[model samples]
Target: MTEPRLRELAVADLAALAALEEAGQVQPWPAERFEAVLVSAQHAVLGLEDATGLIGHAVLARQPFDAELEAILVSPARRGEGLASRLLAAVISRACEWGAERLLLEVRAGNAPAIALYRRAGLEEDGRRRGYYPPLAGARREDALLMSRPLTEG
Candidate 1:
């Protein structure tokens, strides 16, 4: 596969983004929510496409001196590759360009793989939100772990 290309998302890309998001997430975001992100000025939406096509995506919502990662997904068919890590690098790069000093995100407490991935990318365990996520279709509710990383390197 060719190196994935990162591009800013447009309103028309919402459908494809929604599909990719749905495929990767246990609980997917609705189309309406995706549409909102695409049109929101305060958020940065990026699409990652390679020779095969839309491989992954990332979204960052800017705040005063920080930003929150709203979501990041790599297609189920493309997981375990470096696609997610590539998307994460792009998010960190974009966040720095947007003048954000720090970036943070929340992940389901039980998601060990995701937590490990973020830590590898330099995000440290910062805090936790108790019972933050509603249970999956029939699963029990899970807490959310907040992770943060500085945009600048040492």
Candidate 2:
């Protein structure tokens, strides 16, 4: 396998993005939502592609004072290979380039791997939204874990 390359994604990549989302996400964002991200000036969609095509993606949205990690996913088949970490690094870099004060994200409380990844990248737990995610595969609704990391030193 070749090294995965990162690049900015556009609306033309919607089909591959949707397919990857469906394969990787328990509750994937709808195609319309992906389209919105692709077209929005406030959003950046970063895609990681290898010889087989897109293996991971991260969506970053710029706010007035901070940037939010709207979504991120690596293909289930390709997990544990550090693809997510790479995507996250790019997101943080982009946020910093935009002069964001901080970067923020919300993950499912039950997503241990993702939470760990965020923590390792210097994010701290901010709060939680109880039952923020709908039940999956007969499981109860999961809380959303809010996290953030400063982009600039005080």
Which number leads on TM-score? 2
Can you write out model 2's per-residue Cα lDDT over 93-148, one digit (the tens) per residue? 99999999999999999999999999999999999999999898999999999999
In model 1, the runs with Cα more than 4 Å from the true position are none
Q: Give Cα-based local distance difference scores for all models.
A: 0.87, 0.96
Name the weakest run of 10 consecutive residues (lDDT summed) in model 2: 145-154
Native-structure RMSD, model 2:
1.2
Per-residue lDDT over 1-154 for candidate 1, one digit per residue giving the tens place of the 0 to 100 score: 5677889998988878888877788888999998998899999898888777677888889999998999988888878988788888888988898889898999999998788889999999998999999998778889999999988762
Task: For candidate 2, give the lDDT of residue 20.
Answer: 99
Q: Which is the leading candidate under lDDT?
A: 2
State the number of backbone clashes in model 2: 0
